[model samples]
Structures are given as structure tokens and as C-alpha cells.
Target: MEKQVEAIVEWLRQQLKQSGAKGFVVGVSGGIDSAVVANLIKRAAPENSLGVLLPIYTKPEHMTDSQKVIEKCGIDSLTLDLTESHNVMYSYIQDQLKGKNEFNESTDQLAGANLRARLRMSALYTVATNYNYLVVGTDNAAEWYTGYFTKYGDGGVDILPIVDFTKSEVRELAKYLDVPEEVITKAPSADLWEDQTDEKEMGTTYDRIDAYLGGEEIPEKDKDIIELLHKRSAHKRDPLPQYKRKS
Candidate 1:
């Protein structure tokens, strides 16, 4: 574990030195992934790393946990409340659809949720550009594998360090790094909408995903469902399809 942490720190430093970037800019959601990344990168580039908390109607506990992580990791961060930004965009979209044929009450759930994720990404990039830092992403292997992240939203970033680690593995690493117990124990959620959670939305738990990913035996029924998720989310793991003109 020490070696793994050392390697990550080295990788982060090399990423900055090679790119001539000042440091890492991360969105600290108080989730294990974000906490781990922020801690690791700050250790690598203490003077350059910056953590930004962009809370768009975020839960109170989440904000508190995020603040705890910032203090624990000694990260330089600022809270940019995005509740109004999200509301404005959400309202604009709904109003635009009010007179259109696609108007539907059901659109609010997915539409508004994804918009929040995109808005957060936009804010991260803006800070990255201004500070000449790379926007470090926090998606773990389970989230990436299940396509649990919003396309071009949480998925949009200059660098993703935890993509190779499963959700469970992320928790273990977080513990090793002394991440707050509350952040570690909290149920994983995109928290994009009310009463939403990662396992609930994916219809599977991180334990199951980790078992399957590790090639361990599992019930046939669970295996079938896991396979389906992998197939459905294949596109998310690949480059977006593009059409090229024949030269």
C-alpha cells in the first residue's frame, strides 16, 4: 500500500512536470474517490494542488464531510455554491420545452440531474484553465465500469486516477490515507436527485461488482445481470463514435 501510494504521488508529479502545469485541480465531493485523489495529489504537489467544492443543492452532511476532507488533507480549496446556476439552467430547459412536443414531467429527473453534473464539470474546467492546472477526476473502477457516471459530465476531466480501483478498493485506500470515517461509511451516491444512490441506480452493489471483476464465483443470476450492465455501458468506456469524410 505504501508503494502504491508512492507510485501515485510520483505519477501525479510527473504529470504536472511533463505538462508544465502548475498543479492538480480537483472537485472534492466528499466521496472516497475525491478524498483519495485530493489527498494523493496534494502530497505530490502541495503548493499547486487546489480542491474546489461546487455544491449544487448538495446535502448538508456532504458539505460538512467535504470541509473535513479539506482540513484533513491540508488542501487549498474554495466553496463555489452552484445551486442558483443549476436552478437557472434547469428552469431554462423546462421553459424551453414548455411549448414544445417533448415536454414531459419525467424529463426533470434525468435532465436536471445530468445538467448538475455537467455544470460541475464546467466549473472545474474553468478553474483548471485559469490556474493552468489539470482537472483531476475521481471516478473509481466500479463507477466507470457500470457507466454510473454522467457522460461528458463527471466523466469529463483532464485526468482520472482511480479508474483502475474498484469502489471497495477505493474505500480501502481511503482508509489507508486516513479519510474521514463518515465519508468512508456513507452510501455512495451521485446525489444528483433526491433519494438516489449508486447501488440503487445500478441495481447492484460494489461487493458484487468487485467479486465479478476479480473473477470470483458468483450466483448465475447476478453474473447475468452484471454482464448486461457491461454490455450496455460498453459505449461509455470507448471513444465517442465519429464520422469522418472520405479523403
Candidate 2:
């Protein structure tokens, strides 16, 4: 764990130096992935890191956790309320519907959630540009493999330090770094929508998915679920192949 941490830090430092980034701006969602990423950023570049708390109609728990993460890491941070942005976006989309119900309530809710995420990313990018800081992503290997993140939303970032670590490995690193127990143990959620949990939405928990990936003998049902998710998300994991034209 120590070696992994050291290597990651060194790599980030080199990248920052090469890119001439004055600092780093990360979107702290109060989830384990973001918390771990923020902690790592502080450890790697204490003087040049800032965590941004972008809450768009988020729950109090999410806000509380974000504060806890900021306090625990002792890194500089600011809270940006995206309520107005969310409201305006919702209103615009609602007007476009023009009394026609284009989607079910669940689909509409998901769209709103994704809008909030994209709004946060927009704010992060703006800050990054203003401060000449790189936007660090908090996505993990497991989520990336499953296309669990919103494209051009949370997926837009200049750097991703924890992309190689699985969800389980992230918890291990969090423990090693002494992240708050609540943050480490709390239910994994994007908090994009009220009462929405990642595991529930994926139809399987990270443990089962990781085990299957590690070549363990998982139940037939579990394997089916994992395979389905993998197949559906395969496009996100790979880019389109290009063919050479005859010259």
C-alpha cells in the first residue's frame, strides 16, 4: 500500500510539473472514491490541491460527509450551491416537454440527476480554468469497467489517480490513510438522486462483481448479472477502432 501510494504521488507530481498545473481541483461528492482521491491529492501535493464541494439539491448527509472529508484532509475547499442551476435546468427541460410526457418519472428523475452531475463538472472546469488547476476525477476501475459514470459529466477530468484501483482496493487505501470510519463504511452512492444507491442501480454489489472479475466461482445468477453489465458497458471501456484508407 505504501509503495502504491508513493508511486501514485510521484506520477501525479511529474504530471503536474510537466503540464505546469498550478494546482488541482477535485469534485468532492462525499463518497469513498472522492474522499480517497482528495486524501491522495493532499498527500501528493499538499500545497497545490483544493477540494470543491458542489452540492446540487443534495441531501444533508452528503453535505455533512463533504465537510468531514475537508476537515479530515485539512485541504482547502469551498462549497458551491448548485440549487439555482439545477432549478433553471429543470424548468427549461420541463418547458421543452410542452405538456407532453416524453419520459416516465424514473427516466425524468435520472435525467435530472445526470444534469446535476454535468452542472457540477461545468463548475469544476470553470474553476480549473480560472485557477490554472487540473480537474481530478474520482472514478475507480470497477465503475469505469461498468460505465457507471455519466459521460462528459463526472467523466470529464484532466487526471484520474485512482482509476486503476478497484472499489475494494479503494477502501483498503482509505483505511491505510485513516479516512473517517463513517466515510469509509457509509453506503456507496452517487447521491445523484434521493434514495439512489449504486449497488442497487447496478443490480449487484461491488464485492460480487469484483469476485467474478477475479475469476472466483460466482453463482450463475450473479455471473449473469455481471456479464450483462459488462456487455452493456463495453463501449465505454474501449474506443472505436480506426481503419486505414487505401492511399
Candidate 3:
């Protein structure tokens, strides 16, 4: 774990130097992915890293967890409440679709979630531009493989430090980095909505998925879930093939 962390840190430092980044701006979602990314930044560039907590009607626990992570990592941070921005967007979208009959509650909610993610990304980018810092992504391999991230939302970033680690590997690295036990033990969630859990929404657990990915025998029921997720999210893993012209 130490070796992996060191390797990633070195890579990050090189990227920062080559890109001439004065510092880093990250969205710490109070989840393991963001926590690990922030920790790595602290390890690599302690003096120049800044963590941002962008909460949009999120639960108090989410803010609490983010505070714990910031405290544990001892990095500079600021909180930006996106409630107003989201509300303005919600109103605009509602008015735009009022007479079209094209939007429903579910669609609105999904759009709202995506908007929140994108707003956070926009804020981070603005900060980066003003401060000459690079925006670090918190996405991991499992989420990327499953298309669990929002396109141009959480997926938009200047750098991704842990894109290759599975969700389980992230937890292991979190422990090795001495992240708060509460964060390490809590259930994984995107916190996009109330009472939502990642595994429950995906209909599979990371342990089983990781085991299957590692070539271990998986139960029939679990295998079905894994296969379904993989199939459905295949588009996220690759771009559409372009047609070639005759030479």
C-alpha cells in the first residue's frame, strides 16, 4: 500500500510540475474516494493542496464526515453550499419543460443530481483557474468501469490519482493512510439523494465484484448481478468506434 501510494504521489508531483500547477483543488465528498485522493495530495504536496466541500442539500453526516477527513489529513479546506445554485437551476429547468410535458419527477431528480455534480465541478474549475491549481478527480476503477460516475460531472477533472484501484483497494489504502475509522467503515454512497446506497442501487457488492474481477469463483446469483452491471455500463468504459474512410 505504501509503495502504491508513493508511486501515485510521485506521478502526481510530476504532473503538477510539468503542468506548472501552483496547487490543487479537490471536491471532498466525504466518501472514501475523495478522502483517499485528498490524503494522497497531502502526502505529495502538503503545502499547496486545498480541499473543498461542496454540499447541496446533503445530510449533516456528509458534512461531518468531510470535516473528519479534513482534520485527519490536516489539509486546508473551504465549504461551498450549492443549494442556491441548484435551486435556481431547478426552477429554470422546470419552467423550460412546463408546457412540453417532457419532464417527470424522476427525470427532474436525476437531472438535479447531475446538475449538482456539474456545479461542484464548475466551482472547482473556477477555483483552479483563479489559483492556478489543478482539479483532482476522486473517481476509482470500479466506478469508471461501471459508469457509476456522472459524465462531465464527477468525471471531468484535470487529474485522477487513483483511477486504477478497485473500491476494495481504495478502502485498504485508506486504512494504510490512517484515514478516520468512521470514514473507512461507513457504507459507500454517492449521497445524491436520500436513503441511497451505491451497492443497493447497483444490485451488487464491491467484494463480490472485485472477487469476480480477480478471477475467483463467484456464486451464480452474484455473477448475474456483476454481468448485468458490466453489460449495462460498457459504454462508459470506451468511446464509440469511428468509421474509417477508404484510403
Candidate 4:
């Protein structure tokens, strides 16, 4: 584990050196993935990494957990509360679709939820741009493979350092990096919406996802769900579709 951390830290240093960027800006959601990645970047660039906490209608516990990471890692951070902005955008969406009969508050919740993610990404980019830093994403391989992230929202980022690591591996790394125990054991949630949890929303657990991702056999039903998520979210993983034309 120590050697792995050394290699990754060196890789981040090399990437930043070659790109000639000032630093890294990461969004901390009080989740394991974000915490791990943010801390790793901070380790690599102690004076250059900036961890941004963007909360929109977030839970109190989430804020506490995020603060714990900051204290634990001693990483610099700035908090941007986007509750008002989120409300405005969600209201606009609901109002715009109200008369169309194709939308309702109940069914359009996902749109509003995704709006929160986009708003956070926008905020992260704005700060990164001002400081000439890269917006580092916290997505893991399991989430990326299954499309658990919002397209152009959480998926919008300048670079991802741990996209190849699974949830279990992330936990191991987090442990190695001295991540808070509460964060490690806390029910995985994006804190995107009230009462929302990762496993509940995905209808599966990280243990299952990691096992399958690691080439271990799993239940047929679980495999089906995983495959369906991958197939349905294929567009999210690729560049915009376009008509074929000769250059």
C-alpha cells in the first residue's frame, strides 16, 4: 500500500509538472471516493491542492464529515453553498415543464438532482479556472463502469486520478491515508438528495460491484443489473454522437 501511494503521488506530481498547472481543485462530497482523491492530491501538492465543498440542500452530517476530512488531512478548502442557486434552477425547470404535461415534480426529481451535480461542477471549474488548477473528479471504476454519475455533471472534470480503483480498493487506500473511520463506515451516499444512498439507488452494493469488477463470480441477477446499467449509460462514457462525414 505504501508503494502504491508513492507511485500515485509521483504520477500526480509528473502530470502537474508536464501540464504546468498551478494546482488541483477537487470537490469534496463527504463521500469516500472524493475524500480519498482529494487527500491524495493534497499529499502530492500540499501547497497547491484546494478541496472545495459544494453543498446544495445537503445534510448536516455530510458537512460534518467533510470538515473531518479537512481537519484530518490539513488540506486547504473553501465551501460554497449553492442551495439558493439550486432552488432557482429547479424551480425554473419545474415551471418550464409544468404546462407541457410531460413533466411533474415527482417524475422530474432526477432532473433537479442532476442539476445540483452540474451546479457543483460549474462551481469547481470556476474556482479551478481562477487559480489555473485542474478540476479533479472523485469517481471510481465501479461507478464509471455502471454510469452511476451524472453526465456533464459529476462526469465533467479535467482529470480523474483514481477512476481505475474499485470501492473496496478505495477503502483500503483511504485507510492507508488515515481517512476518518466514520467516513469509511458511513452508508455511501452522494448526498445529492434527501435519504438517498448509493446502494439503495443502484439496487446493489459495492461488495457486489467490486467482486464483479475484480473478475469474481456473482449472482446472475446482480450481473444482469450491472450489465443493464453499463449498456444504458454507454452514451455517458463516450463523446457526443455525430453523423459520419469525411474531413
Candidate 5:
């Protein structure tokens, strides 16, 4: 783990040099993945790393945990409360849709939830722009494979530091980085809505995803769920579609 840490730190430095960016900024969601990233960027550029906390209808405990991560990493941090921003933007869209008779109540919940993530993404980019830093993403391998992230939202970032690591591996990295115990042990949640959890939304647990990714045999039901998610989310992992001009 120590060697991996050194390698990642060096890689971050190399990326920064290549991008000509001053540093890196990450949205600290109080989750283990984000916490690990915050620490990593801080190590890579102690003076240049920034942790932005964008809370939109988020739980109070999540904010507290985010603070713990910032303090633990001793990274420069800023907090932006986007609750009102999200409410107004979503409400306006809902109203516009209703007026056009295009509002679908069945998909409303998901729309609002994804709006929160996109809002955070915009806020982080805004701050990063001011600092001339790249926005770092916190998606782990399990989340990446499952397409469990919001496109152009949480998935919209300049770089993903831990996208190759599984959930368990991320937790181990968190521990190695001396991340706060509470943040490390808390159930993983995107905090997109009230009382929402990652496992609940995915219909499966990270343990199962880790096992599947490890090439270990799992139950047929679990395998089906994982494979279906991957198939459905293939678009998210693939490059943007392009039009071809041919003779």
C-alpha cells in the first residue's frame, strides 16, 4: 500500500505537469473514496490541492464527516451550500415540463437526485476554474463497472484517481491514509436523496461486486444483476458518439 501510494502520488504529479494545471480539486463527499482522493491530491500537491464540499439537500452528518476528512488530510477546503440552487433549478425545470405536458412523475425522483450531483459537479468546476486546478473524481472500480454514477454529474470530472480500485481496496487505502474511522466505516451513499444508500440503489452489495470483479464464482442471481447493470451502463463508459463524414 505504501508503494502504491508513492506511485499514485507520482502519477498525480505527472498528470498535473502534463495538463499544465497548478493542482487538483476534488468534491469531498465524506465517503471513503473521496476521502482517499483528497488525501492523495493533498500529498501530490500539498499547497495546491483543494477539497470542495458542495451540499445540496444533503444530510448534516455527511457535512460533518466531510469536515473530518478535510481536517484529517489538512487540505485547503471550501464549503458551498447548493441546496437552494438545486431546489430552484429543479423546480423551474419541473414547472417548465408541466407546462409543456412533458412531466413524467415516475422519473421525477431520479431527475431531482441526479440534479444534485450535477450541481455539485458544476460547483467544483467553478472553483477549480478559479484555482486553475483539475477536478478530481472519486468513482471506484465497482461503481465504474456498474455505471452507478451520474453522467455529466459525479462522472463529469477531469480525472479519476481511484477508478481502478474496488470498494474494498478503496477502504483499505482509506485506512492506510489514516482517514477518519467514522468516514471509513459509514455506509456508502451518494447522498443524492434522503435515506438513500449505494447498496440499496444498486440492488447489490460492494462485496458481491468485488467478488465478481475478482473472477470468483457468485450466485446466478447476483451475476445477472451485475451483468445487466454493466450492459445498461455501457454508454457511460464509452466515448461520446460521433458522426462520420464518408465519401
Candidate 6:
């Protein structure tokens, strides 16, 4: 883990040099993945690293943990509460869609959640632009493989440092990086809605995803669910389709 940490830090420096970017900026979500990223960026460029906490109707505890991560990583940080932005945008969209026969409450729920994610992404990019820093992402291997991220939302990032690490591995990295104990132990969530958790939303556990990635035997039911999720989310992992003119 120590070597991995050193290597990742070096890689981040290389990426920064190559992109001509000043440093790294990441959204601190009070989760293990974001906490790890906050630390990595600070190590990569201590002076230039920034951690932005964007809370859109998020729980108070999450904000507290996010602040803890920023302090623990010792990165220059700022808090941008996006709750009003999200509320304004979502409310307008809902009003425009009202009286439309095609509106579905279930779909609207997801759209609302995704809007929050995209709003956060926009805020991060805006801040990154101000400081000429790259916007780092917090998705882990399990989330990447399962496409459990919000497309063009949390998925909209300049770099994904831990995309190769499994969820369990992320926790281990968090430990090595000295992330807050509460943040490390807390149930992983995108905070899309109240009581929402990653595992619960995916209908599968990260343990099973990690085991499957390792080629270890898992329950047949779990294997099926995992495969189905991968299949359904295949588009999320692919390049956008574009029309090609015939040669």
C-alpha cells in the first residue's frame, strides 16, 4: 500500500505536468473514495491542491466528514453549498414538465438525484477553471465496473486516480492515508436521496463485486445480478455513439 501510494502520487504529478495544469481539485463527499483522493492530490501538489465540498441538501454529518477530510489532508479547501442552485434548477424543470402526460414520478425521482450530481460536477469544474487545476474523480473499481456513477455528473471528471482499486482496497488505502475513522467506516453513499446507499441502490454488495473481480467463486445469484448490472450499464462505460459518414 505504501508503494501504491507513492506511485499514485508520482503519477498524479506526471499527469499535472503533461496537462500543464497547476494542480488537482476533487470533490470531498465524506466517503472513503473522495477522502483518499483528497490525500493523493495534496501529496501530488501540496500548494496547489484544493478540496471543494459541495453539499446539495446533503446530511449535516456528510458535510462534517468532508471538512474533516480536508483538514486531515491539509489541502486548501472551500465550501460551496449548492442546495439553492439545485433547488432552483430542479424546481424549474419540474414546473416545465408539469401537465405533461409523459411525466413519471419514478423517473422524476432519479432525474432529481442526477441533477444534484451534475450540479456538483459543474461547481467543481468552475472552481477548477478558476485555479487551473484538474478535477479529480472518486469512483473505485467496483463502481467503475458496475457503472454505478452518475453519467456526465460524478462521472464528469478530469482524472480518476482510484478507478483501478476495489472498494475494499479503497478502504485500505484510506486507512494508510489516515482518513477519519468515521468516514472510513461509514456506509458508502452518493447521497442522492435520504437513506440511499451504494449497495442498496445497486442491489448488490461491494464484497461480492470485489470477489467477482478477483475471479473468486461467489453465489450464483450474486454473479447473475452483477453480470446483469454490467450489461445494462455497458453504455455508460463506452464512448458516446456518433454518426460516421461513409467513406
Q: Best candidate, lDDT-wise? A: 5
Q: Pick the candidate with the highest TM-score.
A: 5
| Superposed model 2: Cα runs more than 4 Å off | 99-106, 240-247
- Candidate 5 has its poorest 10 consecutive residues by lDDT at 51-60
- TM values, all candidates: 0.96, 0.92, 0.92, 0.96, 0.99, 0.98
Report model 2's TM-score to 2 decimal places. Answer: 0.92
Candidate achieving higher TM-score, 1 or 2: 1
Clashes of each: 0, 0, 0, 0, 0, 0
Tens-digit lDDT track of model 5 for 146-210: 99999999999998888999999999899999999999999999998889999999999999999
**CA lDDT of every candidate:** 0.88, 0.86, 0.88, 0.90, 0.94, 0.93
Residues 106-159 of candidate 6: C-alpha lDDT, one tens digit per residue: 798799999999999999999999999999999999999989999999999998
lDDT of 6 at 50: 93
What lDDT tens digits, residue by residue, belong to model 4 across residues 36-113?
988889989999999899999899899999999988998999999999999987887777777686676676678788
Candidate 1 lDDT over 199-246, as tens digits, reads 888777889988889989888877787788888988878988999999
In model 5, which runs have C-alpha deviations exceeding 4 angstroms? none
Residue 156 shift from truth in candidate 1, angstroms = 0.3
Question: Cα deviation in Å at residue 145, candidate 3?
Answer: 1.3
Which pairs of residues clash in candidate 4, taking residues 3 or more apart in a chain or in different chains? none
